[model samples]
Target: MKSVEEADYVIVGGGSAGGVLAGRLSQDPACRVALIEAGGSDRTRLCTVPGMVSIIHTTPKVKKRFDWGFYTAPQPHGAGRRIPYVRGRVVGGSSAINGMVYVRGHRQNYDDWEAEGCTGWGAADATRCYKQLEDWEGGEDAYRGAGGPIAVTRSRDLVPATQALVEAIAETCGVPVVDDYNGADQEGVGACQMNARGGRRYSSSEAFVQPALARPNFHLISGAAAARVVIEGGRAVGVELIDGDRRRIVRAAREVILCAGVIGSAHLLMLSGVGPAAHLRDHGIAAIADLPVGQNLHDHLFVPMTFLAPTARHRGTALHFLGGMVKEAMHKGDTWFSRTVFDALGFVRSSQAERGVPDIQLHCLPWSYPSPNQDRPVRPVVDKRPALTVMPTLIYPKSRGEVTLTSADPTAAPHIDPHFLEEEADRRLLIEGMKLVREIMASPRLGDIVQGELHPGPAFTSDAELAAELPNRIHTVYHPVGTCRMGVDDRAVVDPQLRVRGVDGLRVADASIMPRVIGGNTNAPSMMIGERCAELIAAAH
Candidate 1:
């Protein structure tokens, strides 16, 4: 290979954590950092405009350009189907393509991490990091932060249907309509907060990576896919990169941080012979460290309950919304398009949930469809009639799956088996969640506008019927984590410091290091992890 390009720190994957680390470390001036991203630029409208999100995941041409579009191996318990897994391959990573919803998750999520032996990662520490990262439009409060990079704004310009859904949730779920669910209490209904500013998405690349690029000490290498971590004498030295027909190596003088999300991080570990020994040997890779690299994989799964709403109107609503979004895109300003598609969000406890903690999350969309397909090419097609879809999602799932290599080739996609709904408890909890959402939709406030149940209709009411039908209806919430889980146990791939066990000069940041997936969205927490990782490295240096 050609002479190596060297840096004080080499971070693989310019996603949430990588972007933040690169930005924070480069600020020191003395620390040279190199961020490697597999995807190209995220400068297109498809990555910036909130309304263009659906189009990015649906259109074949657009999807290929931005998304990794990994399909899971057939899920035996989930109707024996192969699920479409959408992860952003752009410079901003999934943060660019994800629904700009910004949720810090419950503080208990981090507390639990500390309880599980991840010291210095409690609720208090996490909150401090969050305050340091966010520039809230709501201004600084006891709980919220200000004057930071990420712009967090509450949903604005809500449509009538969304307002009704929010009201219905409070009335039927016996919860208050709190302005900020990310604040004092999470168990309530209200508008969602998004990672946006002035109608434009503020992805991690925009918030962190962009500024870091201006620094002379920081270098960004795009379109360079990491093949494996170079290990010598049980220490990670550098990374071998595959850039089309060319190959190169980038040396990490201090450390090698993997922020390549859950799947990508685990895949790279196995490719570098850092995973389960037998599994690596199966692919002809000599094991470097035998650990549970791809175990404890889990995620949130939601089932959509579509309802017909007379108030949503029978004609031109979807078209009118699209037209307005196009106009808003042209003007490059705030409009209804700037808001999340599902403006209303709620957190509630299921019947089987632990006291004072919510197990269910509800996302209410103002628009709906007769049939929602997960196939990448044909999805996101909305019906002309005014309809709403309330997705009742299980926030903390007990089900676990794994990520393993289908081949030794780094370019080939890894085998992702989410093993969704395999656990009886997850299946039971989701059914309870669905029942709770149905009650909210059936409330008097929304009952007037509602026509009828369109999907998993009224006829299927009993628990047995719902259980039988779950396999066909359930899908991922796009938050996969725990593949390279950090803890104090034998199964732990990384320790509390996020350093990969048995390997020196290597760490796995991002969602993969999460001992358990947080109760809410992963994007915000991923960024927080990035910030925390930077602090750790800085202090050590």
Candidate 2:
């Protein structure tokens, strides 16, 4: 019943970016901010527990409650298979359901952004923003953050098998054992850093928005979904929101930012009539701006290679039973995350052509099972059984996909085409990447730990055989980005400062604006964008 006209800033989508913006902007007592989220609150039992990382994305009851659960329009290279897509529909967005791994990606990823017309987003600027937002368990260094809202702790609860796996990777393979991948040396085996603290998940909403909610100027609408921008006199004046049974026209005296994430943000832009003109006309929506809103859709793709777990006598912790029970009881929720099977990770070069750059990421988990059917979420875990899985991820894929509308209805899910493994070069890199894992597994010491190869069995020795298996196991790493890339080029959707080109009083601050997807998980960089974008907006005012 409160009037939205009283607000100076109206931020659509209270996800990763909007949450931080709402929190930072309202610091000025004179400014009033409103954050609108389509989904319900993120304050749920599943979201708070760190161990729910996998459960939040896989479990039927928990996943549907917070995830968008959209599937890609069949991938041509993936046996024409339709891949399941999961985007968060809660206040914290994907951060609520994503694996809590806290990776800042390669430092060069930001440097590349600067080369690609993103003016101030070079490695130097990005590091500053990251340091400002994180409270790393590792003490403050030039690169790591300190005294920040989000708690980031390095993996300390790794199973003994996982520790040996990391050791074997360094000793047998050429890769070194790195203390921190986010540090100066990015190439090597290491424990993953997590956006966790005392075995609890810390989403962006919890990191930035929670403290700001106490301020009188900050307002949040949990179930209000933005339909379109109210453009008048060639300027964004407000947003048309569908609030349950009523339509609300919320005015923005200063600015309107869309942080609906990669898929949602691009969908909203096309709905607002600001994307490719031909596509806009096809949807019966009047074109407001002709920009590439959802054309360059790219994501990190990975292939899982499962192997038998260490033998019964080799398995020391009884399939990680003792650690799981103790942590669960102490945390008041299942602590399967603390005893998380995905403990060991590695960064390596698939080829020497990309010198000084690690193009592939290897994640080793101490468990294995087939993926859940297209309908379910909890990543398949065989109860009480121990196994090992080495996943080779193509960090920098050349193939691009797209996101478009099926209808004008705002509630309908957008059509997504990730175009996974469309490029032959991507196939070649990952095939070689998997070979790296095969080499590690073939190590004499590693041979002592495991029973036998599970998938692509030991007899499938040739590259031709393993390459043939990729189509079956390939899946999204869930790091979709670049639908609304930021740049100074003609095809750019938003400028370096994140303001939408040709649109006054409008900006985009989310994963959608990434010029090129980062080399690692997207959660950390998304929050970094949230932090720097707030500074940019504040400086302009």
Candidate 3:
């Protein structure tokens, strides 16, 4: 193996959290930090196009670069089909390739983490870190922060269908209209805030990595894949990297921070003998620690229902090109319409009688939006005809999955078991959510505009029909988390500070460290984790 020089910190995976950590940690100028990413740079035009992200989802060249095109083991609950799991292999990770919805999740979601044995990770504590990394275009408030690297702005355009969907829900269901979903109450209908600026996607790599490159102390190595962490007498020493055919070892002076996301991070831990002993032994790896590394996997599952409209008023159009120009020229600081149509967003409980905030979310698009997994080119579905799509998502899933080592080889992907709809309660809740969305669409405000149900049709009305059809219709919202869970329990992989349990000179800084998946998009929360991890690492040093 080729020996490499040591650094103050060796951060594995330069994704959202890792990018932030690299930027924040190297701020002192005296500290030498090396960020290793398995994928190449985010220099592609496809990466910056806000609307074309789905186009690159299956493109082999693009997928090879940033996406570790992983798949879950055949899920029995999913009708014995293997679900495709797309994770970022590039510098920005999933943030570079995600929908760019800038959601911080419910405040109570964080508080629940603290209550569930994850100390120092409550709403108040996590929000401080959230504020530290955000430059909210919505302006500074008690909940929002300014002057941060990541830019958070409202959508430049609202589709007409989205607006009508919101109006319909509010008028019928009596849900309030919230300007900011990240504000006091998440249970309402409104527009969605996005991580966009100047009509371009602003990923964490663009926000954090690009700015930190000017610092000489920060060394970012792309195309370097970490195979394992080298341990010396129970202390993590460094990492073994496989760059093409070459094998190299880069030592770490302080710690080996794993920000490789949920699957990547947990798989790396198990590969390094940090997982369950039996599993490690079965994989022919000697056990270093027996922490439950990959046990609590969670994700938001979304089922989309399409509806046809009677008129063309709610249809989306490419006319946004003219609107984009106008926004750039006349209303620079104000709103810029990306599409002619509007979108409505809301949150509601699967059961309103249940305590706490809503555990389900609604995103109504005023166009025939294609699924993220679709291979066909996305052409405007209702360029001249009005259409709408109601997407109901299961936010707080009770079903937990696991990530297990399939082999001792680091190059091989781990066996992921998200176990979607494993529990009957999850299925029941989704059915209820679907029913609620149908009711919203049937409301007097939106009902008059609708022609008929476009998907799952009006015939599939029963709960059993919805449940049976769910597996085929539902797709992931791309918020996978809780594999390397942080808690104060024995099964916890990391402690309150995100330091790996029973391990020194090691830590985890990503969504994986979340004890439970937050109720909304994971990007903002992951960025929060990065900011918090930076503070903890800085304090420790």
Candidate with best lDDT = 1
What C-alpha lDDT values do all the predictions have? Answer: 0.86, 0.80, 0.79
Rank the models by TM-score, top first: 1, 2, 3
For 1-541, candidate 1 gives per-residue lDDT tens digits of 1233999999999898888888888999898888999999998878887777767765788789988879888887778778888898999999989988888888888899999889989998898899999999888888889999999998876668778989988888888998888887789989889889887888889999888878888889998899999999999999999977987889999999999999999999999999999989999999989998988999988888888886653423547767867878686657666756667789888787775787788987776742434453345445666788889988898888999988899989999998898889999998888888788778889867788888878877999999988887887889999999989999999998889999999999999998888878889999999999999988788
True-vs-predicted CA distance for residue 516, candidate 3, Å: 1.0
Going through the candidates in the order shown, the clash numbers are 0, 3, 11
List, residue by residue over 314-354, the lDDT tens digit for candidate 2: 22233454565566777753355452345768888777326
Measured against the true structure, the TM-scores of the candidates, in listed sequence, are: 0.96, 0.94, 0.92
- Residue-wise lDDT of candidate 3 within 351-430, one digit each (tens)? 64357577778877665545433422423133344567788888888899999998999989899999989988888888
Cα shift from native, residue 127, model 3 (Å): 1.4
Order of candidate numbers by lDDT, starting with the best: 1, 2, 3
- Candidate 3, residue 323: Cα displacement in angstroms equals 12
**Lowest lDDT block of 10, candidate 2:** 311-320
Model 2: how far residue 498 lies from native, Å: 0.5
| Alpha-carbon deviation at 252 in model 2, angstroms | 0.7
Candidate 2 vs 3: which has more TM-score: 2
